[model samples]
Target: MTGATQRVADALRDAIEAGTYPPGGALPSSEDLAKAHGVAKVTAQKAVNQLAAEGYLTVVRRQPARVAEGPRRLSVVRDRKVYRDQIGYYFDQNAKPWGAIGTPTRGVATPPAHIADLLGTPRGRDVMTRTRLMAPKGSKVAHQVAISYIPVPVVAEVPAVGSSNTGPGGIYDRFEEHYGGPLEWRETVSARQSTSEEQTQLQIPANSSVLVVTREARIASGRTAVVVEVNETTMSAARFAVSYPIERDSSAGWSSTGGPRD
Candidate 1:
């Protein structure tokens, strides 16, 4: 909000747009930026923080700030059945079918003990995890962050896990195809809040409520195939619309005037 902060933001924005600071590249330190822009160190720090809040940058402990990755392009579709079930808002990306578009990366820590219990797997067992940022088309800010987990055995079914495009049919579809059955059901829990790490990764404002959605999907054979956790914070105001069908009474016949018969 201050002049120094505005200058620092402008510099960072220009760096990103011009590729001076490429994606995944580290940003200069606050002290370095202040000297470079001839502004006070406090001003530079504020500017960096502002950019981080805007989702244009990310700051990791003891590491230089960096340009945050852009959101993945996703295709949105409408489904009547899903709409009726209050799951009408459908979004997907074709770049990766069963997994990520490149080599998968493992998280540093083992699966939390609670998650292991839920999945009936042992703690510290190797698992596959993938993360993605979601945003409205043409927007630089992310609206959601999704993380998915699968046991190593389930992930082995799809070797192309990290590079295949999961378009019309996503990973769930592929699971049915390979295993010859669909998921019997899935349970999801939602909440509102953001951790400091989430704030940095998502570029959300402090204290802003984020929609946290967690899901567990199971197949008929009792195998848990997918565990998804998503955190979404809207960059702007948006609305979700849904519609569905209701049962019709068959015993009632049409009247001569085309009205329902009594």
Candidate 2:
């Protein structure tokens, strides 16, 4: 934010915090805000945009920017995901169950740059990808979208794995069979503004934030580990709480010196 925009934003934020403009309350129009703040209309708009991006305000065309209804409830707990020998890794579990919203899209395509890097493949290389939109069972509301990418070389070794229906156990089982090894999974989480396309697909607001989890599936090969697949999943930050339990390592114990023992 620019200096002028920051000033306007700070003032507006103070007013909101002071209950001058409570939650769900409307704020002045950009034109009025510009005049009041002695800043340009664009700067006032930028101020509103900044607050909207922070989830403090709701912005709609031809409407006065309003304070957000409330803080994120984050009611949905997203931690445990289920897996079975017959289906491999499947629908993620929470208090309420969710499933694929519709038929998944799958085909050969180039993986995203970071995904390709994780798969140890160069960008633009052909790979298989499956995209799925997921929502709670018996509901049409958007919950998450996942894209799973697999390298062509891995698929070539087990052609059936790339098929639309990978039979029982899905691709993970197939990959394990091909590698004669078990897969180890690791995930990294991040936060980012939802893209316009994601806003449409996920049915979220323009400035909504998303919790992004990128997971890599790797397997041991000889004395080295090889990344065979990577899956990227995104969910609305307002609706879901990402919770995970941390296990203490041996180094966590207190030492005679007072710090954790190594």
* Top-lDDT candidate index: 2
Off by over 4 Å in 2: 1-68, 71-86, 90-92, 251-262
Error of 2 at 170 (Å): 1.1
Per-residue alpha-carbon lDDT of model 1 for 27-84, expressed as tens digits?
A: 8898999999999988998898887887778888888988887612232222222211
Q: Over the stretch 1-262, how does candidate 2's per-residue lDDT look in tens digits?
A: 7889988887886566434686798999999999999999999999999989878899999999999987443443335454553445653445335678879888888877888899999988989988888776654555788888888887787787678888777778888888899888888888899888777777676787889888898998789998878999887776666776565767677779988776
How many residue pairs in model 1 have overlapping backbones?
7
Each candidate's lDDT (Cα)? 0.54, 0.79
**lDDT of model number 1:** 0.54
Clashing pairs in 2: none
Q: Taking the candidates one at a time, how many backbone clashes does each contain?
A: 7, 0
- Candidate 1: segments with Cα more than 4 A from true spot: 1-109, 162-168, 222-262
Clashes of 2: 0
